[model samples]
Target: MMIHRLGTMLLLIGIGALPAQSQVAPLAPSDITNIPPDPALKNWSVRTVQIPMRDGVKLNTIVILPRGIKNAPIIFARTPYGAEKALTGAPSNDFRLALPTSYADLAAAGYIVVVQDVRGRYGSEGDYIINRPLVGPLNDTKVDHSTDAYDSIDWMVKNIAETNGKVGTIGVSYGGLTTLYSIVNPHPALRAAVPINPLVDGWMGDDWFHNGAYRQSFLDWVYRMSADKSSKYALQFDRQDVYESWLKAGSVSDMAKQLGVDTMPMFRKLVDHPAYDEFWQLQALDKRLGKEPLKVPTLHVHSLWDQEDIYGAPAAYAAMEPKDRGNDENYMIIGPWRHGQGMVADGSKLGAITFNGNSASWYRQKVLIPFFDRNLKGSADPGIAPVTAFETGANEWRRYDRWPMSCASGCPSRSKPIYLSSGGGLGWTSPTGAGGFSEYVSDPARPVTYRQRPILGTYNPLTTWGQWLVDDQRFAEARPDVVTFVSEVLTDEVRLAGQPIAKFFASTSGTDSDWVVKLIDVYPAEYAEAPEMGGYELAISMDILRGRYRESFSKPAPIPANQVLPYEIKLPNVSHRFLKGHRIMVQIQSSWFPLYDRNPQKFVPNIFTAQKSDYQKATQRIWTSARYPSRIELPVMP
Candidate 1:
């Protein structure tokens, strides 16, 4: 009876009428297939091809040619992300808009842009290994990123119709890693390389881990990358607050299992090897690239507030500097950017902090473009210095003959110790009193969140991952588990141009612990300029060190319970000025929350596999005295 009533209703509505069928008729072949070309893309020619590697694997490559191009040099980029999307996703008559924003100046300068998908990603063929190690001890396979890069360059120079055979490699993050790999056994046509925020060492400081503390947030990325060749999938969460999600997920291993990423090779390796083992050491790009003399003119771009891969640019530059005997081939650009923002966005401001001008645009037009023209196009001198750094507080750029003249090997920079004293004070002089310590109770159950609560996923559109480095530190300073040591208002500006070393005469009641040190710039309480920034605590440089690996990064051992020990934490490089009327601050804590996996406090063989019971509250102490003066050695610029 219900079926009969439904049929009568359909007949009354004329659901299958002849006129309705005509209205829903399929589009004509010409109407569907022959669409007018975008007027905006009229000046650009875009095409894709499968370029074969030495191993017979075909990588999907996109070649973009500018209008009326002739004898043009090639700007090449290899990436795991989709080449088609990166190179030609947006169709525009303006060549600058046709490519990534970072390459805008180069795009206007008229060069053949080539982008390709690395093996086993996107449209490329072959198994994808995250940061595939070079063909050496760690990887017995002949096909690696370096080899693939060599083959790709060889193919491009030989097959492309462009007259000029010169090629320059440039990319950021993973793509930046590929750019570095290209210079390993560079192709004859390869002239220049720009590795911006490249992934150099995973276990030491880059992605995955920083000084043995795992960045568990990267698990979502791993799951997405390894799930399939396409970028369609994303890790979903039942809760919007990632801090809560991670806290409730228990151990890193448990998180992996719950996400069902435990079976992935990358996740398994991360879980299996929590320490800096041979697996990681052998894959370090700096160690590998530094072994040979510099073959290509390379420019290393480092972001001052690079939330990810902060240690890579300087580390790689330091390793390769000695090889550049003439000092003309190796160059470094340090910008006030978060990750790849230097190339991708207007660098006028970050968060609430504003640079006087568009720093990124200036860098691209004045520095990056000229660098490429000199090496790739055989242009005259661009007058680029060995080090081009953006001074944060000063809101300007400075040229230096060499970088970190105060801290690097055989450099002239002096290391001035700023002692952490009692009463939450920081001073240039050593403490004269007897041994005294500042104490805090570190509980794993309530690990301090790296940022304010309701932290989003690493790659989430609304995630603070990019700007968190420059985020105000007042949130962390307000916590009880976190200890703050602030200096008196400066009478004169204090400039720092190199790495800051934190010397902690510290101890933990438990057998294991973690130490997080932050160097901050405290603004004045009352200010006319940017009133909202009043009393802001801006972190200049910060890093974490797992206590087990304090003695040796490769080895892990438990701390002596309740015993005083000296741990040296090397903070990332910085170029900043503590303006007069401002204060210098240092905040030390045991946990950076789900950002870095919580230290069990109770020593376990492997933190990844540790049980919930392994986590406990421990009394952590920081000693200050003439004999054991806990201080941060700042590379104060003369």
Candidate 2:
């Protein structure tokens, strides 16, 4: 059972979180008998070392090289999955590991690769604190993996031989985040870097919540896995039969029984800290990394379909690269796959669709390799475009000087912010004068979580976790329970980039209620596009919130029953371009199932303390008037 839990969590992290090949074995020095180097690899060596951190933790790492060598100049990838394991993979992420042949091949070309386990986890010594640790009000220690990262690289440069006194780093997801954090200290010897789909912040608002609402499923699965490290609930956890039973039973609302029995303490802690308050502010890379100017050339990689840590990658790109510096140097890529899945596809996998039929080889040969080569090998710039996005249906790469419409750089006509009228229409003519208001009754009994399974075998599990993929507002629209305001079909193209903020000037009948802002690209009434790969039409969507944890993330306050509360939540950013004849849809509802924990409508010390009887069905109001305008503020191409 414990193995099942670990296995389940492993699935969440899986190939998506870790790099690939086969999981490497931890062996003693006697086992270091060198295997003959593949002909392709002539210059590097495989060496093992213990990197000592300030806190007396000796982290383990492996240096992979081209031949029998000393410091061939290092490119590091630090992971929580263990140093040797960093380069390996689970059965699924198998192919991503550079084969002995590929390594030999790259080595023949020349570049040393080093991998390490972070401060804890795997063979490392310190306690693994999951992510960039929290030095919040509860615990005020101005220390984290950031400091440890700095210290280790500081040590590696001086001691390692082949290193001409410099290092470059790269990785996808977790490793990618490590790369960004490692470079922030800007080791004197560090040259260049790349971070793909990195987890941006620990703020419940970002990683685990979409607008004050708790994002479940993926978070639930991950937390449970992290808690036990073994699978006590493996059978019931993975079995679809048991899934329904658990679903019928309850979601995390009954965490003690339905799923995570041991994770409540931490879960409550996360729920308690809902906003980007001091707790999240401290752990977030945004705050920490910003304090220092990013001087290195970085390639921000993201998957268009990426569901995990999707919010962070793009934001980091916008951040590290100075907007003032307009150059091809700070590049970005968004592919057709999710969670970096398509990045290493041979095709047979990826739900029911086989990416193998249509794989992007350029990623391996032209992009990633060339990147490591250019930086570590000190080769000239490869002339790759600044922005390369894979157009889904086209399954082809499109290059641009910047994200969104390149030509619209200085265009003024396209920049416009449409408003959501109370009655459900969009634009200036949507009627704001006479009685601009609407209501919805939120019932906690039928709380909406994600419709798909939590782990694999589920569709769009990361971002769509806890929420159903086919969240057609049609059902909610029919229910007097959901308030949806949509824009008219655009006559021309309008591209929105950067984060979009939704300002809700309204009130709620309940002491605590959640307002979910979902930005969706609504298909035409009679239009339907065939599924690009999974036979499911792509529904590009992202959301954010307003809830009980309004002004204070750490502290909680009720809505005062019938009083109005002005709320605003910065929805996830979108690089979407609304073309001719398409309508922009904004869905505001108080409920999203299992993907988010059900919000108990009554005001109590904590929702956790509320009884089932306290779960009341409360009314919500949307006041759309000139005085209290509730609208989405989008960043135009400019």
Candidate 3:
């Protein structure tokens, strides 16, 4: 039975004979290829090929055969991540093995699948360069990602004689990034592609940088642990706390001794460059920002709560000019998930919330298999109206032709701002009567700690993926050590799409003070239910914004403690159908722990080097009004 994929249905409706139900068979790893496979699909052979790249670097690749046939349609996945069967392919239904998935999924579907390890990591050859060194005055010898992807495709096209020549790429995370990178190059053989949770763009500003201010709670450092190599520095230092731990554990001398000369150079360099600089130039992947818009069809599957690359995915997708976003060639799917894996960011249990199903299953059944079935097999696959996303709070899937907004004729005339009045609530008018701005003393010595603790497999000390974002204001609520801001109840549903920006006008008594803004959807009642196991949501959903690069990310300077400084940070992209009976809420604070590190009240050269004595609590003031109202601006869709 064939499913009416996105294309076939569009074709049928074009010819007019359409009252049909979609046919879909949820695929399982066991259903992949049986050494002989079930006679249903067809026969295929396997071949091993070595692909060479620029400068003579070679990558080991595997080609899946189709019924011993020659020159058939080929599907490609160029990945630096290995394609080891036991580790890479699909696992048992119970996931008794590693990841229950593999290249077999594609091969079994009747398409010839080609898999390769990226240069330097697995079987591929070449010196790994996470921070590609500046060899010449301007260029770096280390082969960049673009050249790598381009070279791999060239090899597949010329050497892989049986491949009908057409190739489509797919992968998650690193592979996803490569897929996105591949299309930018305009390769003739590469036509259709899927970049699942691709690390598309923005290293600093996304989750790691958070508008120039680093997300302490995010474990960007530990990832250094698994970079191109497991070297002395990579092993000795936990990227998450090298700066802070070195200062606290008094391990500088030991660290310097352990990392010696060769290792610590790069880690130390990053600390010094704090803001976006030349160091991030060759290292960041988003450099391909405006590369020629795709000439072929594409499917970009990204996760919303993904700890690693959410910022890049949506930012890159939304950044496309209208001209570049034409046709079904480019489709975007974002699930409430963390990093490159899983669909729902939440396992459905946030302190008290729980979602029953795993997003991967749905993604496999509804999106993955069906998508390929339509494009490759020319089968009848369902249109895009099916599995767009499950509104976590509402418990349902909503579909639209495009993301961000649903057909914006012109920013809705109904746009309005809900002001933050006195008494910690929102209203239409500026609560001048609520008096002046509230203040908090930020102390570096006894700095308010970020509540997140270390988890088992967490490489970064402050990785806050899969945590709670509730009203935990009791500790900092009236404390002089924290800043607070609140908005009034909304009279109507502020349907929103796109990203939110939290702008703050603040002054600190110390050289530096961390500022965070959160946009909350205040629900109607304490709608707590055993079925909705995830705590309370009369509080709805929330997102945060940090302040450090208020002026710019490249430079850092103290605010002289009390002088006011205005800063704005970009929050994550969101799609919420805030109902009419709900209220729009926003909160501002200086600290959000284990998820982020504590900001010692003092303005020191580095956050990690500050001492307990330097943690003197300083006063913080927030300014608001129609003129500079510290606000949360969202993309309101119809």
lDDT of each: 0.88, 0.60, 0.55
Ranking by lDDT: 1, 2, 3
Candidate 1 C-alpha lDDT tens digits along 477-549: 8889999999999999988999999997898999999999999999999877889999999999999999999
Best by lDDT: 1
Q: After aligning candidate 3 to the native by TM-score, how far in Å is the CA of 136 from where it should be?
A: 10
Each candidate: RMSD: 5.4, 13.1, 16.7
lDDT of 2 by residue, 1-638 (tens): 99999998889977676665666767766956688546553322457888887767788888775545554666677876556653444322122244332333344445566778776556667665656553455445655655666777788788777666667777667777787777665777677777877777645434565545566544444553356433223313445433444345544545544555434455656656655567666766755655667676777787654566666766677665564275755777775556655345442234432333444455656676677667766778787777666543324455666654462233432434567787687674424465477777777775443333332323323333322332444444445676778777778666655457777766777778877776666555554442432212223445645466778766667778777667877665455566565677776778766555567777766554346677778888887876667777776653
TM-score of 1: 0.94
Q: Return the lDDT, model 3, position 111.
A: 65
Those runs of model 1 whose alpha carbons end farther than 4 Å from true positions after fitting are 1-33, 38-41, 87-90, 406-411
Pairs clashing within candidate 1: 40-93, 405-413, 406-413
Candidate 3 vs. true structure, TM-score: 0.75
Question: What lDDT is obtained when candidate 2 is compared to the true structure?
Answer: 0.60
Q: Score residue 286 of candidate 2 by CA lDDT.
A: 57
lDDT (tens digit, per residue) of candidate 3 on 397-428: 56655665453243432334555543465555
Query: How well does model 3 score by local distance difference test?
Result: 0.55
